[model samples]
Target chain A: MAPFAGYDMPISYPTGAVEEHNICRRGVGLFDIDHMGQLIVSGPDADAFVSHTVSGAVLDMKDGDARYSLLLDDKGLVLDDLFVYRLPGRWWIVVNASNLETDVEWFTLRAREWKGTVKVEDVSEATYMIAVQGPRALELLDLMGTPKASSCPRFTSGEIVIQGTKNLFGRTGYTGEDGGELFFPAQDALGLWEGFIKAGETHGIEVKAIGLAARDSLRFEAGMPLHGHEISPSINALEAGFKWACDFSKPDFVGKKALEAIAAAGVSRKLVGIEITGGVPREGYDVVSPSGEKIGTCVAGMFCPTTKKYAANAFVEPQFARPGTEVAVMAHGKPKSGVVVKRPLYLPAYRR
Target chain B: MKIDSAARYQASHEFARKDGTVFVIGISDHAQEALGDIVFVELPEVGKTFAKGQSFGVVESVKAASDLYMPISGTVTAVNDALGGDPALVNRDCYGLGWIAKVEATKAGEFEGLLDAAAYEKEAGKD
Candidate 1:
């Protein structure tokens, strides 16, 4: 166990971390996303408030729809990456687990700037989140009384009534699997978790309690970025491959001018995927050219069990962004060979 | 499943058995379990001198890397090269074939501060 934000998180079970990681990839696994913070932005200026605070176009979204977005600082550096879903009469924003307090403060201060009536309320303590991911995730969920096996659009959500509890369910996940993120009343979480595990047993689905350790490795394998690692207050959204999220065409938003300049000049450094051999490539490992010239730095990395290789994502000089660009990772005080590739190291086997 | 109550331990988890000037040094069973599956072990070269608690080498497990510290001030007299290929021996036989390095203690009083097997068993039992 390791200390993370005052909680004792298990890095690996006695069985092994490698096995735990593969279990999530090949079969269904349940994750306790209860640590993540949720907030409700409501009132007359709800749409306008979210539009101004986030990089995405939340103002244009209708109820029951979700959009991927980023919370940017005044200079347009990312403070947090989030998903905001428009609910009936309110907008629900899901912020990163470790950045709950910081995100709440960021949103609260911005809500005060709205010219119209808007109230930002933190509902994280009153709600709970559970992520069920894998190829059979929907099937097991169907057995639990979730309606419809049909696929929902990538960033959309649907409300479901399960076990007499109303759950706001979204067809989204970070594990690169066919799964859903469900938010329900906090009092119903333990019962819901037990029910899922018991029902998943006979279907040959494995139930494991995923912690931050496996979460990091699985997200790395799926090419998903974490807040502090890949996106930070000092990094721009364009260089981090979040350009699609920013809509400059819309009316004025935060840091639009800086982002326009970045897009026009082209990014000097770009985030690229790299596969390493000889040793594990961890965060902050120096990326160098064959001649030993430093070219970049690893933002996140892990030993990917599916491919049986060590992989990393680095923000390298633009000259090295193309696939097949050769680079060396300085590991254990030695140079190890690696090559830049596209993200999504493990292609999902899901039918979707 | 059994622990030798007479063996002594250092805070670094290395166990030392003193017989005159020579001391047999290996990691304790608790250390092996805490490290999980050991993948590689790097040992110090023979004739290297170290004060008590000096890091002698590194042990890489599948999950993490740990540094092996000397239990007592000593001069390295022999090294265990077999561990380079089969580091799992440390998990299987930490007190026997898993012995990492042998040393001739320069400070005989250093072993006095180490915990005997009974004391270590009590320490391990607490958690």
Candidate 2:
């Protein structure tokens, strides 16, 4: 166990991160993600308030639908990347645990300024979250009495009952595999954790307890960005290639004007994929040009278990952003030659 | 984790035990367990010399990379090349197959200063 975001969380099980990562890729894996933050945004002005607060089209989403979104500061810098769910009569926003307090403050301040019946409530302490992810994830979940979670398409959220209690179920996950996330009262954490483990054994299904270590690699292999690394207050959508999550055509939002102005003038930096030739690249490593001048920084990098290559994400000058551009990353105290590659390193399994 | 009675241990988890005329050194089982899954180990070249507490190499786990410190001042005679292909041997048998290096000790007196198995276990237990 390790301390993360003020919570004592499991980093991995005894089987190790490599096996746990393979289990999620080839078989099944379970994640205890209770540390994530869940918030409730409700009242008469919810529809407009949500659309105004987030960059995604939350107003158009049908009840029980969810979509990826982001919160930006007034200067168009990323505050946090989040998932916004349109449930019954409220907006459910799930965010990174590290940014939970900041998000609540941002939303509460905005709601008060916009002033209506809209309400913001932090329900994270009262709830537990877990993810069942892998190629065979759905098959194992189907055995439960919960009716047809498979029927819902990806990114849909609804309700399912386990042990006679209703649980919030979403066909959403952080890993690039096909899977679902479950949300319930904190008291149900242990029973559900054991129940899934038992089911995996009883049915001869392959299941592994995935921790934060494997979770990071799983997302890294899929070429997804973690907030504090790839997208943070210092890194914006314009530089991170995350403009797809922003809707410039939509009406006035917090950062809409600033993003439009920045996009028109063009961005100075670009986030590109780098493959180290002789070693693993790591976050904060200096990305140097062939002439030995620093041009950029490595956002994240490691030995991708699935790819068997040392891959990294870097923010570099636009001239060096093209595929096949040669560069070097300072790894383990030495500069290792590398080249820019076409992204993403790997796509989500569903797309394949 | 069991401490090898034949070896003397540094508080940082490295162990040194007399082999024929040299000392064999490696990290303790408790160190491997705390490091989780190790993916790569940067081994120093043969014949490299270091002070009693200098950094010898680096151990890269799935989570982070940590430096391996020299348990006693010596000239490295051999390195466990097997770690290049399988670093998890350290986690499996830290004291045996995972022995990191064979060093010709220049300061044999430092070995006597390190904690013995019973003493090391008592110190590690406090963690």
Top of the candidates by DockQ: 2
TM-score of 1: 0.80
Q: TM-score of each model's B chain?
A: 0.91, 0.97
Instruction: Give the per-residue lDDT digits (tens) of candidate 2, residues B18-109.
Output: 99999999999888888877777878889989999899988877778888899999999999999877887998899999989999999999
What is the number of residue pairs that collide in model 2? 0
Question: In terms of docking quality, how is candidate 2 classified?
Answer: medium
Q: What digit string (tens of lDDT, one per residue) describes model 1 on residues B1-127?
A: 3465556886567888875669988888888887776656768889999988888887766567688889989899998788765677898898888889999999978788889887877777664
Residue B40, candidate 2: alpha-carbon lDDT? 74
Collision pairs in model 2 = none
Per-residue accuracy of model 1 over A1-352 as CA lDDT, tens digit each:
7776555767776656656677787777688878788999998988877887788777678777888898887667888899999989999999986788999998888778875488989999899999988777787777775565235565688877778878888888888787788899999999988888888787777766666667777877777789888899878898898888887776867777778878888888988889976566778999999899999999877667677666888999999989999999997677889999877787654423
Instruction: Quote the positional error of residue A265 for candidate 1 in Å.
Output: 3.2
Interface RMSD for candidate number 1?
3.4
